[model samples]
Target: MDLGNKLYTLRKQKGISQETAANEIGVSRQTISKWETNSSYPEFDKLVLISKLYDISLDELAGITNINNKEINYIPIKTHYEYISKRKIGNIPLIHINIGRGFYKAKGIIAIGNIAKGLLSIGLLSIGLISLGPIAIGLLSALGGLCIAGVSIGGLSVGIVAIGGFALGIFAIGGFAMGIYSIGGAALASKIAAGGYANAPVAIMQDTENIKTLILNKLPNTPNF
Candidate 1:
C-alpha cells in the first residue's frame, strides 16, 4: 500500500484522531491531514520521531520492502580545511594529499587517505628527479599538492616542474595553487585539461593532466572530507 493508506491504517489502529497525533508530534492538524493525503512527505528527523512514537522502525514507518537500506554512503572526493576553533591562528585552511594509509593508534583520527596518496606522489617525484627524467618529475609535482601540508615541512623541497607546451612565464609556483596548475605539464594532465577542466586552487587533484583544481580554504566552512 502507499504511504497515505499506511498512515490512515496506523492512525486508526492507535485509536487516535489526527488532531491528537498532530498535537503530540508538535505539528498542526492540517499537517497530519496533508500527510495522510500524501500531499507531502515528513522531514527526516520528524519521521524518526514519528516512528518512535508509533514504536516502529524507520523502514517500517516508511513501508520499505527492503530490509537493508544502506543509503547515504558518503566518501569525500575533495579536500577540506577548517580553523583550529580555540585559537585564531591565521588559519590557512589545510588540505591533505593522502600519501599513506594506516589508522592512527593514538587519536583514532582517520587521515582520509590524503596523506598517504600525497606521500606516494612525492615518492614518485623523487625517483623521477633522481633518474634525470623531467617528464616524470613534472608528473609527480603536479599531483603532489594534496600531499602538501604543515608549516614544519618548511624545509621540504616541492620540486615543481610544468610539462606542457606552454612557456614557463605563464605559470609560476604559488604554493599548492602553483603545484596544481603544473598538472597540465605532465602528459597525463594533458588528457584532463583537454576535457575542459578549469583552474582552481586544488582541494583534491584527481588523475588528470594540465588540469588544475583549486580548493578554497574558507575559515568556518572547512570540509570534514
Candidate 2:
C-alpha cells in the first residue's frame, strides 16, 4: 500500500473526523484531505505528530513492512471518556464527567474531571458554590491545597474566614495569619490579635514588646486566646 492509502486506513480505523485530525495535527482539513487523496504529502514534523496522534509507529505510518513483507496490524486505543446525565437542571446537565489524555473541561450542576466548573465541582482545578480539589475557588466554601472562597481551608487560603498554613481574611487562623481578628503562631491584625507571637492594637500574647495593649487575662465575651 502507498503512503496516502496507509494514512486513510489509519484515520478510518481511529474513527475520527478529518477536522478533528487536522486540529490535532495543526493543519487544515483541506490539507488533510489532500494528503489522504495523494494530492499532497505531510511534512516530516506533521508526520511525527500524526504518528503520535494515531498511536502508531513512524515505520507503520510510512507503510514500511516487516522483513516478511507483511503489514502490521493496528488497534484503535480509547484515549477519552465522557458522560452526561439525562437529568437536566435548566439547560445544564445534572452531572457531567469528562476525563482523557488531553484537556477536557466538565461543566454541569455537579461536575467531576481534570478541570471542572459547576454548582458543586471536584477536580484538579475547580470552581463552584462548594469546590473540593487541589486548587479550588468556591463562592461559599473551598477546601484544597490553594483555596479562595467565602470560607476557605487549605495550605494557602484567602476568604472571609480563612484557615491554612498561610491565611489572610477578615478572620484568619493559621501558622502565619493576618486579618482584622487573627489567631496563629505569628498573628498580625488591625483590631485584635491572639497567638504565641501577636501584633495588634489590642494583643493577647506572652511577648509584651510586640503588644501595644497587652491583655493578660481573657476578656469577657471573648474567644479563648
RMSD of each: 20.2, 9.3
Off by over 4 Å in 2: 1-72, 76-79, 207-225
Off by over 4 Å in 1: 66-225
Q: Candidate 2 residues 49-125, lDDT tens each?
A: 98899888777777666335687643233355455666789988898876656566888999987899999999999
Cα lDDT computed for each candidate against the true fold: 0.38, 0.82
Q: Considering summed lDDT, which 10 consecutive residues are worst modelled in model 2? A: 210-219
Residue 188, model 1, lDDT: 22
What TM-score does candidate 2 reach? 0.62
Give one digit per residue, the lDDT tens place, for model 1 in 1-225.
566666788889889999887767755566578678876556666577677777777676776642356432221112221111122224321222222222211100111122222122223222211211121222233333221211111112243333233312123232321332333322122111211232433322455433222232322333544
Best by TM-score: 2
Alpha carbon deviation, residue 119, candidate 2 (Å): 0.7
Predicted model with the maximum lDDT:
2
